[model samples]
Target: MVKSGKTKKKYHKPTKPHHHLNPPPAQANKPISVKTLPAHLVLEILYRTPVKSLVRFKSVSKSWFALINHPTFIKMHLDFNTSKNDKNKLICSCGYGTFIDIALLSLSEEPMNVLRINKDFTERPNYPRKINFRDFSKNMVLAGSVNGIVCLSHSEEMSERFVVLWNPSICCWCPIALVETKSWDNMSVGIGFDEVINDYKVICIVPEFRFEDYGWSRIEVYSTNQGSWEDVDKKGKIHFRPNTDLNHCNFIVNGVPYWAGLDLRPGYVDVLGRIDPFTGLFKKIEHPKHVRNEITRVNPVKLRESVAALIQSPGDYPNNVIDLYLLDENTTKWTKMYSIGPLVSGNVCEEMQIPQCFSTGEIILETWTWDTDQDHVTDLDLVHNIYDPKTKLVLHINHMQALHPCWYESYSHVESLVCIKGMVQIGKEHRDKKTKPKMKNWTEFLSKEFDSVLHL
Candidate 1:
């Protein structure tokens, strides 16, 4: 019928079907052109999510990875996490020889719970087993605790010996070899996370090295995964030891470690050290500013995730307290936060006290009473004062009279036994939920267990 002279139209071979059904139009139900939201709003949403989700989102895109790793963003996220329910445990060890009396306290709720974990345990055949220093012929001291792992160092004949990693939860003990021979005079300890390897590391600093003699500091780092220790060569000509007395605690913020020491003068200044868990490299970070007092002791406490807090008393005595500064991760500048109340109010606050800081905004302070007017500060007894910064109220007050006998015996030189403020809280949990519970808090449950050990 139709003898068309015009060439018939030919359709090209069918390509792969993006969608197959009733052969709908190509642009059927296209994804909506979602408008990009402002970065602030996006950050707010990301910040509200749990740390697990935020960490997972880091791998979504290069933009996200860079954003999350940014110093400012890291600080904000850390602060938000710190404001949540944070639990910290305080451990106090007293005794010169092997038979040291160790006391454990829980700083969770308003009223602090103090439990002495020296009792005997049926599960542990070595109930209240006397830690014999004579066996090793060296005296051991509890250096510090991190994530429920305790560091213990001992010395004999003026030789600083090995350090051990003791986990109180499982009663498992792993001793690290003595990597250095220097005395423990100006030494401090800290543990932190390594994001690159997803493992934990412990750093020990002995400020006993002489800059004029060696022109370098003795910085040591330990990794759990590697099961070894290595020396960190960070400084060029700056001397760490012999410049000033080691006063502050070693603090860990956002997985980085830091401590307080003197700069050129006898005055105090903050010193930062980054531990590369992979290479075990310890490099010194520039101090933001120097404090006034020669005895400017820094109490570095973790107020939140990215916030490393410092409470510096202008002078050695507690009276001249001025400002509490929070360090910014991005600028690395210290910003003055709220002023803390007087160290002593003529209230129940006493001498030989330690302020136990937690991310929960609560400070667990240990106080002792002694006649300052007397010849020697020997008759001091122990007490605890718990304060909540949020409510600005005193939560609990208790006397640690059981530890008085040990204190009196060791009070010959109160300065050496004084616990510094930069000490990290033991039994702290990691951001990873998969990790095991490091702190057992066995004080309540294992009271009978530890009691038998001491009696034996």
Candidate 2:
């Protein structure tokens, strides 16, 4: 009885309510602190990123957005990508009607393929269709591309011609004021950037009409910084005939525009004219000796910081040879760097159009071929040949089979964050004022179809 009583007497303290008590500290998990990188270091890393990545990264933060959109950052990114040879997408336009198809070509892959299709700029639904045939030709000419901006004219001969500066990368466009010109004129327009003024310029060359024949050209320039067109002085006007093939003949190299120049007069050699973007003045440079006599086509391309010309000529039976000449800016001399074959057998390339050249010495050639016996152009053999200068190996890519080459027009484009409206703000805006409405109708239709399939 005594033992039982002693054991039962032991009592526990009453439990207390701890409702207002403080919680235990977060278990020694690593202390959370955001370690922001230095601004310059962050910018250096962003500059090395791809343009598409940069565009998407704009949503990261306010500071990141501002850094990506800064002019200095944009230029630094461009220069960095250019140095790395990362900005080498070829944009090609095919077919002309109510809608056009613009395909982005990727040569970075082993077998080049279409990277993306941009129908937004091609489908100019707001454009007036009542324009005349001549006007239509001028508007759809696809003058050329420079630093991701493309220039298009609507009226070449009229006093008031409508022009568009479009940046396909951002899907933004600006219509330039009507460009005024003289009567009975043939005009060639080229757009380029001026590093000196840090502005974009448009060069218009109208050949003088002399007794129903082409003669000395009158040059006019439009500066985006000034937002007006001005006449180039007589000294700045070139005497040679402008190349009719503006798409292939005109190119921008190191912020200057180069065009294939020809003098119909006897003993006058064909030259490459370099137009100064700031002053509108031009200087003629001699062509390489080998391709001077039998030049079928001349493509001026960017080679390093200077310029290079791709010259093509007919070779032995069922073959063609392409020669690449680089210009020494100091001496103004042409030095031959590469000589691509007498292409492979059975592949007769009639017209060789070079869209781009990589710093790795790879040349992307777009060619059109014809049947030897039929003497007519054949669309079956539309191919893009990538020639490696070091190995002299050619990789044939059948572009026609994939893109159905209907009036193929290709240009080398470097993707950029440049705003067309920023460059030409005086003109009407082409970008939609608001974001495009979500495809509600299509989404609903697809959902209903899926439900029906599930029930079935």
Candidate 3:
């Protein structure tokens, strides 16, 4: 009776023979430590990750933190990215007065019918303080960007104005002390890196008050390594076209700042005045061809290994074509690279600014244009064109009219982990007092800036 009362034996379900035949790999449950990875493999992994990821990984462990912050690692990562033909992004600053808007546009090989607003600058950490365009009466201009650091200055009538050096990647920024110059009129500033000294520099050109008709300009340079401004040794005898629109005059190419020089003479030769920040030498390069009697705009851009000029003809609205010419580094000969457009059928290009051209033959250009239905008197629309020289394929990217102005500032930037403050020591006292605030999580910050802008 006791045996009968015992519970019936539970039926056992048969397991698959394969399940018992093979157990999980030993390393499956126990994740391999990153420390166990070969050093070269680890470095390769870090190099491929985005800068924001590297910044956060600095907290993973002391070893990782040190490695991420190490100067050697930083340089290697930058080099790797630069060599990999990474897509260059366009950073655009629009709006005027207190409501200035900043955005980033990601360029892709895939044809895009519409230009998507990438990231808004307002939502970014360490962005320069907003100034009322009405109060200042001037739009903020991006002086130049080098190694992911952008120098921003607002139009202030004062002889001395504040300039901000910002690293959007790390969200770090430092304001250079008030830059004092002879005249704010016709003044231009540019930022560039010096490979020899491994330093970053800011070059300022201020018109010298003079009676003579010949336009004269003075040069002052601020070295990040020195953390101070010094008059260029050959400051005198510097000449720039009087009344030059400094806003569009300066750009960086191959670690040098090139300022557009007005043809003071009757001859219509466009000249680019280049300054080597390291040696502080100034030289002028003549345009590819003497543009005959036409109002031409010359944009000096870095094209692969050498500097190239993107020249627009008849510099007025409703233009039909653009000429690209690359400079020979050794001979200084300007060779015609490609003739872009008869653009999109209905669009009339008013102005074109070429930011960057890759060795892969893709050229990024910002154009201000108007639809054929719209007259020249109408406001020009902002358009971005990605032209493939090889295939002559043009991808027209139309953006929101509200976000882009007739005169927005744009720069081509490569991603880097460079520290803004580390580029050059600001003063010890200034550095201690003006430490950059911590940035919000990049993923979260980007989402907020782009959520409303990007619908696709």
lDDT of 3 by residue, 139-196 (tens): 4467787777877666644225655677767766666655543445556778878999
Residues 138-224, candidate 1, lDDT per residue (tens digit)?
Answer: 344454554444555544322244455554433345545555544555555555556676555666666534545443456667776
- All candidates in order of TM-score, best leading: 2, 3, 1
lDDT of 1 at 333: 77
Model 3 score (lDDT): 0.62
Better of 1 and 2 by TM-score: 2
TM-score of 1: 0.52
| Candidate 3 lDDT trough over 10 residues, lowest sum | 111-120
* lDDT agreement with native, every candidate: 0.48, 0.62, 0.62
Candidate ranking under lDDT, highest first, comes to 3, 2, 1
Model 1 off-target regions past 4 Å? 1-87, 94-99, 108-138, 157-159, 179-188, 207-211, 231-238, 242-249, 265-298, 306-322, 343-353, 368-382, 399-456
Pairs with steric clashes in candidate 2? none
Weakest 10 consecutive residues of candidate 1 by summed lDDT? 409-418
What is the per-residue lDDT of model 2 for residues 1-456, given as tens digits with 9 covering 90 to 100? 545544557688999967746544763455769987655566678777767688889888655565566566677777776666655665666544444555666654432332223223344443564332222333355556777777665433332455567776665566565544444245676777787778887777777777645557767777888877765565544577776655333566766777776765554557777778877777778776663334466677765456888877734434467778888888998888777877645634366677666545567777766555465555545666678776789886655345555535455567777774344322233434567676433323323332232231
